[model samples]
Target: MVDHVYDPPERCVAGSVGPPGQRTFFVQATDGARRTTVSLEKEQVRLLGTSLVQLIDEVAPREGSEEAAAAYLDNAPLDAPFDDDFRVQRLSIAWQPERERVVIEAYDRPDIEDLMGLDPEGDYPWDGLPPQSLAIVLDAPRARAFASRCTASLEGGRPGCPFCGQPLDPSGHICPRANGYRR
Candidate 1:
């Protein structure tokens, strides 16, 4: 008999929430499919950034799907609210199956404006450096399942000693305690 193991779900490819007061937004996942919609308070729209129209033009998907979600991220035209002198230096993607969420972490650098061609040697007038981190959550079950399968494959392939329940390497272990007890 073939034993079917429980697999988690996939991670979300993309998602977003409006600023304050707006209802929460979500990109729900279904059978490897994704759906996007505006489901949040009106006040939340302000948090999207200063150029709402540009942001929507770049990120808001006319059609909902994983591909569309990825496109949104690739073309996201995020603008700095405080100043026009900033750029994303690094970006990281993480999926949490237990929480049913996908997180995008971004780290901004001081010379971002110069790198993005906005300005050369432009002084960022903000009180302090822009935050180094940002997170966006999306719903993706298939991603979670994939992650689970990968993790299982790695754990199942580990070599261990049957008698002692200890992991074994090609180089055998010398157990002094076992030898002393035997003596």
Candidate 2:
């Protein structure tokens, strides 16, 4: 008997938005094996300044190995092109070997407001916001450190997502995935 390793399709290509007030978009990569969706804010999309396909090729986790994938995500720094105006406020990476899926989330922080906006009571309006969060699914090692830090920052002292400046509930949000889906 032989055990075979399977690689899931790369979902959510990376790219950036064009100028301020521009809408940025990326495609979810599908290879008939898996389907994923990468969501980012208009500012983050602008910060990427590259094609989603190119970004996925550059950041997708390794097949059958979570450790390698986590390392890839941890070391995969935000592109320098938009580093001046954008920073990775929060990041969540999850790898499901059994399902051959990896979910990488990066909340873009364009500034202090973006950071504070994560708080539901931070004095910002979030009625029409498109969930300024990004999630990438693939097969790889779980990036626990990033997720832990993101959660701690959001729920530790202040209450918010820390990355996108959105309000958060220590008890969790209606989305259930609040606190990075920590239970």
Candidate 3:
């Protein structure tokens, strides 16, 4: 369940802790008085950011229209440090037309054990841990900025192979498109 909900985030940005591809991705939300940072998968970061841009483009606003939410974030350092309790496993995004905001929810990934496709709920003792979640709301401007930042961050990593479009490591990449030939 989501315990924290920032209805209107003063700052909401997707950032990383270390170098590209080697760093952990995080989305930080701040409401002036409180702040929270949640870790996420790199793929999730890319998809979420891309989707946000698409959403904003679909509802393109005029130069001085009132539909825009004007919640622009500076993409500064996160107010709160990353914590284990905020590890995100699942993400949900939605558009609030009335408020002209984009709502994003990050949920902690659940743990489950399966024995040969059998459920382990009754066989094992409970761990007494619950999945925590955070929900952040962003305006159009802020959402656009965040999406751009995320896309740029993802692109800053190692270049991809032209043959297979797979990321090439420092050594090189063996592209399957060329029958396992190094590209």
What's every prediction's RMSD, in angstroms?
A: 20.6, 16.7, 4.3
C-alpha lDDT score of every prediction, in listed order: 0.34, 0.38, 0.72
- Runs in model 3 deviating more than 4 A are 63-73, 78-80, 110-127
- Write the residue-wise lDDT of candidate 2 on 1-183 in tens digits: 101111333322344334323423332333455433344444444333223223333455233233544453332322323322223454444434466555555554344554664765664443444335444454333332222222222222335554555545555444334545532
Error of 2 at 144 (Å): 18
Among these predictions, the greatest lDDT belongs to: 3
Ranking by TM-score: 3, 2, 1
lDDT digits (tens) for residues 1-183 of candidate 1: 111111221332223334322313222222234222212222222222222223323443243233544432322211212221223444444545476444433344434454697565667654364353334444442333222222222332225555564545455554454662321
In terms of TM-score, which candidate is strongest? 3
**lDDT by residue (tens digit), candidate 3, 42-137:** 899999987887777777454212233334535476555566356776777888888878888887754333234656454433246665789888
For candidate 3, which ten residues in a row score worst on lDDT? 62-71
Which ten-residue region of model 2 has the weakest summed lDDT? 1-10
